[model samples]
Target chain A: MMQRRPMIGLALMAVASCIAVAARLLVVRTLDGSLVVGWPGPTLGQFRVDAVLVACSAGAALGASGAILQTLLRNPLASPFVLGVTSGAGAGVAFASLAASIAGMAAPTGAALGAPALAGALLALGCVLLLSRRHGALDPITLILGGVIVGAIASAGSTVAEALLPPERRGLLTGWLFGRIPEVPDMGSLAACAAAALGLTGLGAAWGNRLDGAALSDDEARSIGIALGPMRTAMFIGCGVATAATVALCGPIAFVGLLAPHCARALVGARNRILVPAAAVAGAGLLTAADALRQWIDIGGGRLPLGAVTAVFGGVAFLVLLRRTAAGWMA
Target chain B: MSALRFQSPIIARGAFMFAPGEVAPSAGRVTVLIGPNGGGKTTALRAAAGMLAPEQGAILLDGAPVHTMPAAQRAARMALVAQRPEVGAPFSVRDVVALGRVLRPASPERIAHALARSGLTQLADRPFHALSGGQQQRVAVARAFAQHEPGGVLLLDEAFAAVDPPEAAALVREIRAEAAAGATVLAATHDLSVASALADDVWCIAGGRSTAFGAARELLTRAALPSLLGVAVAEAHGSRGTIAVADYGGILPEAPR
Candidate 1:
C-alpha cells in the first residue's frame, strides 16, 4: 500500500496531462483555426500553437508551486494565493502597470524582474505575518488572512492603474492584470516553467523525509535530527520562487494555488513524494484543460478568463470533497 | 549510564528556565522530576532536550554547552517522549513506534526487538490509534527505547500517567535497560511508585523550585509523596510509604500523625 500510492499519483498525473494535451491539440486545430480569418501565414498559425504551449507551461508551474507549498507548510490549505506569495508578484505587476501608464510609457517595458520581485516581497511579508502570529510556521487562518489582505491591495492597485491609463494602453494594462498569453512567443514564460519544475523536483526529493516528519511535530522532527528552521525556510523559499514564476506567466490565477494541493491529496494521500509531483501535474492538467475549454467554447466574442473557468471547477471539486468527507467517504 | 548535566536558560511565556549556574543534574542514574501541576517540570525537560529555549541558561551534555547548538545536534544526544501525545490518523502499531526512531524504513529485526522489549511484539501490526491507552503508552515507550543511544539522555514527561501499574512497571524496566545500556534516563511523573522503582536519583520540584535533589530512595520517602499531593507525609517503610490522610475512605475521620 505504501509503495502503491506514489505510483498511483504519478500515473494519474500522466493520464490527466495526456488527455488535456490531446484535447488542447484538437481545440487549437478546430475552434482557434477558424478564428484566424486573415491570409494567415504559417508563422501566424504558429502563434496559436505557441499559446497552447505557454498555457501548458504556466499550468505546470502553478501545479509544482502548489505541491511544494503544501508539503513545506504541512497544511492542506497552503498554496500560492492562499499563502499570499503570488500576491507579491501580482502587486509587482500591478505597480509596474500603474507606473508605466503614469509615465506614458509602454506596458511590459519595465525591469523584467519587477513583478517577480514584488511577488517575492509579498511572500516574505506573508512569512513574517505567519511566523509572528503565535504560530511559528504557516497556519491556515494566518495564511488565508494574509493572502486576502495582500490580494485586496494588489487588486486595488490594479484598479487605480486601469482607471488612470488611457483607453489605448488600458487594454494592455488589463491584459497584464488578468494575464494574457501573447501570440508573440516570449521565452520568459518557458523559462519560468522550467525553473518552477526544477525547483519542485529538487526540493521534493531532498526534503521529502523531513517534510513528512514535520507533519508529526517540530520537536519530533528535531528529535529525529532534522534541522527544522533551515529546512522550513528553504521549503518556503522554494515555494516562493515557484509562485513567482507562475504569477509572472499567469497573472495570479486565484484558486488553482488553493485547489491543486487538495485535489492531489484526494487523489493520492498526504504523503509528500506522491503529493508534490501529483500537485504539479494536477495543476498543469487543470490549467491546460481550462485554457483549452476557453479556446474551444465560444462564450462571448472574445475568450473568457481561464481563471474563471478553473475557479468554477476547483470550487466544485472542493465542495464535493468537503461533502464527501463530511459523509465519511474519503477518510 | 553516563550522567546528564543540564545547563540552559529556558525563557517562554508561562515558563521559567533554571540558569546553568542555577542547576546541574548529576549523572549515571535515573533523575525523576516531581512537581505540582504546572510547576514547569515538563517545560524544564523540554528545555533540557532543546525543544524549548531557555531565556537565560545554557544546557550542557556531559559538561558541554548545547543551548546555542542546533536542535538536531541536541537530538543526537537526547530523545523525548511527551505525555498524552496527540497522534492524528491511523497507522500500524509498528509505524507509530517507528516514529520515535527517525531513521527511515525501520528494520524488522530492530522494530521487533523494540516491541518485544516493550512487551508489544505480539501487537506489532495492530493499528496504533485503536490501541488502549495503556497499550499506546507502551508503544510510545518502545519508540523511546528504540531511540535510546548509548550515553544519550532520554527524557520522559509524565509518561506513566496513561498506563496501568503493571504496564508502567514493565515500561520502567525497559527504561532501566536503556540506563543499563549507558543512557541517562530522566523522567517526570506523578507516579511515585514508578519513580521509586526505576530512578536512581530524584529531583523533586514544587512551587517552581527544586525541593529535593538527592538519592531516589531518600526523595521517594513518605514525606516527599505528600508534597506532590499538597499535604504531609506520616508513614514510611521497606517498599511502601503510607500517607496518613485526614480521611481514609470516610471510615476514619481525622488521624493525627
Candidate 2:
C-alpha cells in the first residue's frame, strides 16, 4: 500500500502534464484555427505557444521550489512569493531598468536580467535568514514576518521605479508588475529557464530521503546522518534560483507555488520524493489552465492577466486549506 | 557489540555542563543511566550518539573518535531514540520507521521485524500524530530497532517514559534480546525499578557529574536513591519483586554547586 501511493501520484502527474499541454493546444486552436507553417512575422498561434511554454515552465519551477521551502521552513504557508524571492527579483529588474533609463540606455533583456534578479533574491533570502534566526534557531513566525517586511520594501522600490518610467512605458511595466505572462520573444531565454527549472527540480527530488529525515527534530535528523546545515543551505539556494528564474521570465505569479504543493500533499503524503514532482505537475497544469482561462475571458482590449486568474483560484484554495488546517486536518 | 566510550566534558546549550568523565559501556550489556531531572543524563547520551560534540576530549566507538568520522559512517554504527521525538508531518507509522533505514540499504524484512518487535504491526498504517504519546514512543523504538546494525550501539533517552507497564516490559524484553545478541544498549530513565531489573550496569548522574558506575543491583540502593533524587525514598519488597518509591518533597532546592 505504501509503494502504491507514489505510483498513483506518478500517474496523476503524467495526466496533469498532458492536460497542461492539451490546454495550451486548445488555446492555440482558439486563437488561430490551425498552426501557421512558415513565419515571416510572429503568428497568433506562435504567440500563444510562447505564453503556454513560459507559464508551464514558471509553474513547474514554483511548485518544486515551494515544496522544498515548505520543508525547510517547517511552515505549510512557505513559498517563493511568501518568502520574498519573487518580490526581490521584481525589485532587481525594476532597479536595473531604472538605471538603464537614467543612463539613456535601452532596457536590459534576456540573460542580462538574470544576474540582478538572482542577486536580489539571494539578498532577500539572506535577510530573511538573518532576521528570523534567534539563539541559533529559525522561528517560523519570525521567518514569515521577515519575509513580509523584505517583500514590502522591495515592492515599494519597484513602485518607485515604475513612477520614474515614461508615461508610454508605464502600461507595459504595470502589466508585468501585475504578473502577466511575458511573451518569450527569444528561444534562448526559454531554453535557459526550462533547463534551470528541470535541473533544480531534479536536485530537490534527489534529496527526498534527507528531506524526510529533516522533518524530524534537529537532533534526531543529525543522529540519523543527515547533514542539516548543508541540506538546508542547498534547499534555500535551489529554491531561490528556481524562483528567481521564474520571476525573471514571468512576473511573480502568486499562489501556484503555495497552492500546488498543498494540492500534491493531499494527493500524495508528505514524502518529499513524490510531493516535489507531483507539485510540479500540478503547478504546470494549474498555470496552463489559468492562462487558457485568461485567454477565454478576454474582458477588455487585452486579456486578463494570468497572475490575477491564478490569485483568485489560489486565494480560494488557501482559505479552504486554512479552514481544514484549523480543524486539524493536517498534522 | 562495539564498546562506547565517552572521554570528555560535554556541554549542551541552555543546560548544565557534564564534567570530564569516561563512560565504558560494556559490550553485550544493557547499561542504564539514572539521574534526577536536568542532571546531564540526556547530554551524556547525546554526546555518545555523536549528536553533541564535546568541548573537551572525545567519544569513541570501537576506539575511533565519533566526531571525526563521517556522519553516515557514524550513523551506520549506532542509533539514538530521543525522548519525545518530534512528528512534524502526517507520516504513517511505517513511513516514520523507514526513515531509520537512511544510513543502510533498504530491507523490508528488517523493517517488518522491527515493527513486530515493537508491537506496532497493528498500527503501522496509522498516522504518527494520531497515535497516543506512548504509542508514538513505541514507534520511535521501532524506528531505532529497524536502523540497528550488527553489534551496533543504541542510545535511548527516556524512551519508555510514556509507555504503560506491560508494553514497557515488552520493550525491555526487546532491549535485552538486542543486548544478548551483542549490541551495546545504553538507556536513560527516572524509573529506578526498571533500571535495576534490566541493567547489567548503572551510571548514576547527579549535579552534572557521574556519582557512581557499577552493577545496577549494587548501586540502586535505598540509601543512594534519596540523595540522588533529593527526596525521601522507600523500598517495598513483595513476593512479586522489589519496587523503590519516592516521596515528593515539594521540589527540593537545587543541589549546591
Candidate 3:
C-alpha cells in the first residue's frame, strides 16, 4: 500500500525515542548537575533538556538534509562531509579563527560569523562545476569528486590556519570540524530550527512524482511526457538548500546524507513519494534517539559529541545496506 | 467500428524513411509489416504507435490528427510493445505489466483478462528481471493488451521472435482474437511463415523501400522467396498459397512438414 513498513518504522522510531527520553529525564531529575558519557547515571535536569533538544534537532537537520541529497543526486555518497560541505565549513571556521587572532575575536563568534556565508559561496561554486556544460548535472561520482577536491582544499587551508593559531583557538576549529553543537542559549537553535523548517516545507511542497520520473532514464521520462530541464534544476536546488541549512546548524555530519535515503528505500521501497518523507522522518527519529542515548550514557565528565554517535551507527548501517543491495547498487 | 488511417506521412530515422499514402484499414484486421533487417519496419511501427515523431506525416485515428496530440493522449488509442522490453528494476512481473495500464484506467477484471489471454497469469508474481527472455516478451505483449482503448490498435515490433514456436503461435492466436474482437492490429516480423499464417495484408520491405503491399496470398510467390532471401534455394513449396523456405544449397535442411 502506502509504505506500510516505513510507517511501522516511523512508529518504532517514536517508541525508541520516548523510552530513551524518559530514562534521560529520570537521570536528570535524580542527579545534581553532572552528566557522564559511558554509564547511565543521574544527570542534571537542565543539561538533560539541553542534550535532548540539541541531539534531536541536530539529528533531524542532518538526517533530512542527507535524505534530500541522496535522493536528488541518485547517489549513495552525497553526504555533507563526503561532498566537501563540511570541509568548506571547516575552511570558513579556520578563516574566522585567523581573522579573530588578527582582530581578537572568540572562536564560536568567528565560526558563527564566517561559516554560513563561506558555505554559500563554496556551495555555489560546487553547483557551477557540477552543472557545467562539460559536466552537466550533479551525477553521484562527479559530485563526490568535486566534493573531494573542495574538501581537500578546505582541509589544507584549515591545517594552515591551525598551525598559525597560538594553540588555544586551534582546538575550537577541530571540535567544530568534528561536529560539536555550540551551546547557543536557545537563539541559535531557533535559527537552525527555522532554516530546517523552511527547507522541509520546500521538500514537502515538491512531492515525489516528478522525482520518481527522474529515477527513470531520460528517454523514458521524455516518452512519458515529463519536461526535463526544469525538473532537474528544481531538484538540485531543493537538495542544496536543505543540506545548506543542516550544515549551517550542525557544522557537517558525515554518512547521514549518504545513508538515510537508502535505508528509507529499503524500509519503504523505491517509490519516491513515500520514500522521501519516510527517509526524513526516519532520519529525524534516528538522530533523536541517538541524542537521547548520548545524554543517558553519562558515566564520565565530558559529553560525547552526538555527531560521533550518529557516524558510528550510520557507518555500520551503511555497510550492512551496501552488502544487502550490491546488485541494485551495481545497476 | 472506429477507422484507423495514416496520411501521406514520412517517418524517418537518421537516413531511413517509411511513408505511404493514406489507407484506412477496416476493423478486425491484422496488418503485418514485413521487411529485411534495418528496413524501417520498427520505425514505422514506432511512428504508428506515436513513439517517434514523423518528419512529414500525419497519423489519424477516426480521421483526426493523432500525430499532433501529446504522447499520453495518443497512447490512449494505441499500445506499443518494442523489440526488447527494457525493464531494469525489481518490479514484480505483475507490477511491470501494470505499468502499461498507467495511461489507461482499466479495471482489475480487464487487466486479469488480458494477462490470462496472453498466458502470463501464472508467472505474474516473479521478479521481472529474473524471468527468461521469452517470459519477459510475453509480459510485454500482455502489458500492451491491458493498456489501450476499448477497440484500440496494438502495434508490435518483432514481438514474437524471442518466443518459442508454440508460445509464438499461441500469441498469434491471441492477437487474432483481439483483432476479431474489434482491434486494429499491426505487427512487424522478419519470420515470413508467421506473416503468411497471421497477416491479412503483408507490406514487404527492401532497401528502405516498401513494395508488394497486398494480401499475403497474392504477394508471397515461389520465385520471390529466393531473391528476397538473397540465397539460392534447392527447392520450395507452398501450402494453401502460404510461403515456406526449404533448403539453402547444401548448408540447411528442408522445412519440417
Q: In DockQ, how does model 2 score against the reference complex? A: 0.43
> What is the C-alpha lDDT profile of model 2 across A1-331, one tens digit per residue?
7779777976887697777666665543234334322323457556767877887788889998888777777667778776677778778878887888889888776556766776777687777777777646566567779889998998898899878987655544455566766665446656766877797678878888888888777777777888776677667667777787777677678889988888788888788888888888778788888877776674545567777898888899889878865544235
What docking grade does candidate 1 earn?
Answer: acceptable
Query: Predictions ranked by lDDT, top down?
Result: 2, 1, 3
The C-alpha TM-scores of every prediction are 0.80, 0.89, 0.71
TM-score for candidate 2, please give it: 0.89
Docking class of 3: incorrect
Candidate 3: tens digits of C-alpha lDDT, residues A72-146: 455555554554656666777777778778887665552364454346435644644463323244454565566
Off by over 4 Å in 3: A1-177, A180-216, A220-232, A293-304, A328-331, B1-75, B78-89, B103-107, B153-161, B164-166, B179-257
Candidate 3: tens digits of C-alpha lDDT, residues B1-257: 55667676777656766776565555688888876788777766666655555667687777777655565666666777888776433456676566665544657777787778778888876766677788878888887777755678878888888888888888988898888888888888877777766788777666556655676656555565555645433323444444554344464565697
Give per-residue lDDT, candidate 1, residue B39: 73
Question: Across residues B103-208, which tens digit of lDDT does each residue of candidate 1 receive?
Answer: 5456767777889887898899776656777787787778776666677888888887878877777787778777777777788987666666777887876655
All-Cα superposition RMSD per candidate: 5.3, 5.2, 6.0
Q: Model 1 over residues A98-124: C-alpha lDDT tens digits?
A: 676678776664235345445544555
Candidate 2 lDDT, tens digit per residue, B1-257? Answer: 68888776566466567873877889899999988898888878888877666777888998887766777787788898999788566678998898898756878888888999999999998888788889999999999998888799999999999999889989999999899999999999988767755688888887778888887666667877776677676676744466666655546686697
The most accurate candidate by lDDT is 2
**Per-prediction DockQ, in order?**
0.28, 0.43, 0.18
